[model samples]
Target chain A: MKKIVTIAREFGSGGRYIGKLAAEKLGYKFYDKELIMLMSKESGLSDEFIEEAGEKITNSMLFNVAMGGVYLNPGYNNTLMPLSDKLFVVQSNIIKRIAEEGPCVIVGRCADYSLKERGDCLNVFIHCPDEQKAERATKIYNMPEKNIEKEIKRRNKARSSHYYYYTGLDWGSPSNYDIVLNSGSLGADMCADIIADIAKNC
Target chain B: MKKIVTIAREFGSGGRYIGKLAAEKLGYKFYDKELIMLMSKESGLSDEFIEEAGEKITNSMLFNVAMGGVYLNPGYNNTLMPLSDKLFVVQSNIIKRIAEEGPCVIVGRCADYSLKERGDCLNVFIHCPDEQKAERATKIYNMPEKNIEKEIKRRNKARSSHYYYYTGLDWGSPSNYDIVLNSGSLGADMCADIIADIAKNC
Candidate 1:
C-alpha cells in the first residue's frame, strides 16, 4: 500500500530539501513550492497571492483579542474572508487528491491536517535548535547575522499560528504527528534517509 | 548547562533500556522503574500502588462517556480521586528535583510534561510498527505471540489516556516533544546514541 508522508518543519531546517530527497529515493511525487503552483493552477488563484497568504491566519492575535476572545469560528459561512482560508481549502482538496493518486511527500502547508482522516498518511515534523536555524539562515540563506534569530522566530511563529488557526491543534505537538525528528544533528540527507526507510515500511 | 532528557515510549519499545544507555553515555542519572521507588520515598506512597496507577487514568473510554462531556476537571478539589493523579503529582515533584540536581534521563510517567517549563529539557517519544512491537515482545520479553497485539494496544491506550487526563495533551504529539524516533528501524542503542549526542550538545 502506498503511504502519504507529510512534513511540517521549522524554518531553515532543510525540510523542503529532505522531502524532495525522500520522494526521489522512494520513487514518490514530491510537493513543496510546486504545491503552490498546483493550487494556483487548480483554483485559478495567483501564485503570488497564495504564497503570501499561505502562512497567515484569517485573523491576527490583535484581531482575536479585539473580538473579546481568542477563538475564531473555523466553519465556512461563505462570507468573504482572507484568501488564505480559501487557498487552504483548495490546497487541502488538492492534497487529498494527491494522496489518493499514490504515495507522495508533502512539505508544509498543513498537509497533515488536510489528510488527517487517511489511515495511510504519516505526518512528520522536522525541527532543529534555534542556534542551528539561525546559523543556517546566516550561512546558507545569506540572512543578516544580527537578524537571523528574529527571522527564524518570526517564521516559526507564523507557521505555528497558521496551523493553529486551521487545525485548533498545537503546531509541532507529537500527538498531531506520527513522527518528529530533529535535523540539528542529522542534517537533511540523513534525516531524509530515516524518513524514507519508514515510508517504505509504512 | 545541565540538560534533562525525558523519554515517552510505547510499552515494548525498550524506552527504559535506551534511557539507561543514554544516561550512562552522557554520565547522567537514569530513572525508570527507579522513579517509582523515588516517588514512594518522597511522597509516602507505596511503590506497588504507584506502579499500578502510574499509567492509568480515572477510567477508560467508559469514563469519557459517563463524564457528560469529553473533558474532566483536572483540578484538585480536596476530594479523594484516583491514586494515579496523586502518584502523577508525586512523580512530577520528584522529577523536577532530579532535573534541578543535574543532567539526567527520565523515562515514562509524563516526565516530559512535568519538566516542560525547563528550557534545558529535551523530550522524546519512541515508537515502532505493531508487527515490530509484537516481534520484540516475543523475542526480548519472551511473551506469547498470541497476546502481543492485544497487550500492545491496551498498554498504549492506557498510556495515551493517562497522559491526556493529566496533561490534557496527546501522548505522542511532536508539538509536545522535542524529538521522536522509530525504534523499529534503529533499535534502542542507536536511538539512545543519537539522543545522547543531542543531550550532550543541548
Candidate 2:
C-alpha cells in the first residue's frame, strides 16, 4: 500500500477537497494550508511571506534571466537565495519530515516532486474543465473577479509557473503523476474514492 | 454507470491490454483493431487500405495547407475527401452505432472524441514513462528497432498528429478525457481496476 499521497492540482479543481476526503477515508493525516505555518516556524520567515512566496514567483522569467548573474556571483551571493527558493527548501524539508512520520496526504507545494524519492508515494494531479472551474470559483469559493474564467486562467498560470520554477518539471504532465483525474466529470467524491482505492491496491 | 469506455493511449502504454482486462471485468465488448475491418465493410474500402488510413494521415500538414483549395472548391471537390477523413467518418459512425447497442470498451481511433455527445461515455487516456515504454517495446513486443525509444516517440507523434488533424484537440490532454493513467506507476492491473471502478460508479 502507498504510504504518502501527494496531490498536485489546477486552481479550483477541488483537489484539496479530494485529498482531504481520501486522507479521511484512509485514516491518514491531511496537510495543505497547514504547511504554511510549519514553514514559517521552520524557516523563521513570516507566515504571510511564505504563503505568497510558496505559490507565486517573485520575479518574471525575463527578469530572472536578466538578473541571473546577481544570483550566482559570489560577491552578491551572501544568503542571496530568493524568498521563493528559500520557502521551497524549507517546505521540501518539512514534506520530507512529514513523509517520514507516517502516511499522509500533502496537497500542492510541489509535494509530488519533493516526495518522489519515496517508494510509497502516490502522486496525483487533478484538473477540471475551464467552465467547471469557473463555476466553482464563483459559486463555491466566491471569487469576485468580473471575468472569472480569465481570473481562473491567470491563477492556473501562476501555479504552473511557480511549480515549474521550483521543480524543473511541467506542472500537470501525466508523466510526473501516477494518475490524473477530471473532478468535473468524476465528481470530487468518486475521485477521492479512486485515489484511496489506488493507494490501497497499487 | 458509464456504459461506453473510450481509451486513447500513448504508444507502448499497454493501454490495449488494460482495456481488454477492464472489458472482461465489466463484461463489456472490446473493440480495437476490429474497427478496421468494420470500416472497410462500411466504406467499401479495402481492409488493408482502411487499416493504414484509419490511424495515419496520407498528406503532411504542410501539403494539406498548401492544397486546401483543392479539397474545398466545388470545381475541384468531386468526392475529394481525403482517405483518412473518409475512414474517420466510417469509424465514427460505427463507434456511435456500437455505443448505441450496449456497454463496450473502445480503444484508439479517437473514439472518445467521436462519442463526445454520449452521456454515458468514459474517456480515458493512458500513458507510460518513455523508459518503461521502451523496455516494453524491446522486451514484450520484440520490436527490431535498434533505437526503440526513437521509434516509440515517432509513433506517438503520429498518433498525436492524427488526433489533432481530425479532432482539433490535443491528444493526452487531461481536459479532453475523464481520467488519465500512467501504466508505468500504477501497473496495468491496477489501472484496469481503477478504470472499471470509475465506469461502474461514475
Candidate 3:
C-alpha cells in the first residue's frame, strides 16, 4: 500500500493544503514549498531564483538537450547545464530519489511526470470552480477580490505550460492522471482523506 | 474514433451544456432527458415514476431479489419486478443498446457504469466550485442565492449516492473515469471541445 501520490492542481484550489493533510494522514513526507528550497540547496541556486524559474516554461534549446538524453550520457558535465535545465534535472533526480526512498505526497512541479513510469504512484489533479477559487484566494491568500481572477489565470497558465514543456503531456487531462478530485465539492480535508484512503488501498 | 461519451456531473457545472455541445460537434446523438423517456417507453412505466426512482437508491427487498438473479430465471415475471428494479434494468439495457447503436453522448443516469464494459467509451465527470455553481444556478435555474448552497449540496448528495448504490464506486473519483474536468476553470465550451478531441483521439 506504499504509493507515491503526485498532485497537479489549479491555483487557489487548495491543492497544497490537501496534499499536506493527506501526507500527514498517511504519515508520509509532504513536498511543496520545501521542494524548491531543496532544489536551491542541491543546485547551489538561490531559493528565490529557483522559485521563479520553477514555474516558468523554458524555451531554451538547453532544456531540450538536457531532456533529450544529457543525463544518460555521463560524459556531459553537470555544472555546465543552464539554470533552468539544471533546476529541472536536479529536481527530477530528487523526485526519483525520494520515490526510491519511500511513499510521499508531492504537490505540483510535474511530479506526476517525474514518476510517470512508476506503477505504484497515484497521480491526481485538484481543481475547483473559479468563484470558489477566488474566494479561497481572497480568504487564504488575502488577495484582493479584484485581482483574484487575474492571479488565478496567471498561475494556471504558468503551471500548465511548465508541465507541458516538461512532460510533453496536457495538464489535468484524465488520461494523464489516475483521478481528478474537485476540492470545492469534496472539501480540502475530505479530499485529503480520500487520497489517503486510495493510498492505503493501493 | 467512434466512441460513447458518458458524463457524470454536478448540477450547475454545465455538464448537460457541455455534453450537448460535444455531441453536436461530434455529430453524435445526445442522451439525457431523452434517456428517461426511452426507459419509460421500453418498460411501460410512467416517466415520472422512472425519473423519481432513477436517482433514488431503493432499499426495497424486491430490488435486491431482482438484482440477485431475476433476469436469469425463467420463472420471474417482468410485471412482478419492483419499480426501482425495473427502471434500473431497463435503463441499463437501454444504455447498452444505445452504445451498441453508435457513437453518442450520454449524461447522468450512471451511463458511465452502464457502458463500463465497453472499451470504446469515455467517462467524464464535470464539476465546479460552489460559488461558480451557485452563480449558474441563479442564472440558469433561477434559483435564489440563499437557497443555492442547500440545493447544490442536496443535488450533489443525491447524484453521488445514486451512483454509489448502483456502481459500488465512489462518484467523481478520478480512477472511476478517464478524466474529470472543471467547467469553472476550462469553461463549458472549451471543456466540450476537449471532450470532442479526446473522443477523436480515442
Candidate that scores best on lDDT: 2
**Which residue pairs in candidate 2 collide?**
none
Weakest 10 consecutive residues of candidate 1 chain A by summed lDDT: A64-73
**Candidate 1: where are CA atoms >4 Å away?**
A60-78, B1-6, B9-31, B34-123, B126-178, B181-202
Question: Candidate 2: where are CA atoms >4 Å away?
Answer: A58-79, B58-79
Write down the worst ten-residue block by lDDT for model 3 chain B.
B66-75
Docking class of 2: medium
Worst 10 residues of 2 chain B by lDDT: B67-76
Candidate 2 lDDT tens digits, A54-115: 77664564544443412322334464654456567779999999999999999999998888
Ranking by TM-score: 2, 1, 3
Best by DockQ: 2
Q: Report each candidate's C-alpha RMSD, comma-separated, in the order given.
A: 10.6, 4.0, 19.3
Scored by CA lDDT, what does every candidate get? 0.78, 0.86, 0.79
- Write candidate 3's Cα lDDT for B65-177 as tens digits: 65442333233653455555557778999999999998899998888898877878877888877788999999998988887799898988888887887789988666576
Q: For candidate 1, write residues A1-202 as lDDT tens digits.
A: 3388899999988788889999998899998888889899997777876787677555654543443433222565545544555667789999999888888999998998999888777678898878888888888888888767887898899899889989899897655665688787556777787677667655
**Interface RMSD list for the candidates:** 5.2, 0.7, 12.3
Winner by TM-score: 2
* DockQ-derived CAPRI band for the predicted complex in model 3: incorrect
Model 3's C-alpha root-mean-square deviation from the true structure amounts to 19.3
Clash counts per candidate, in order, are 12, 0, 3
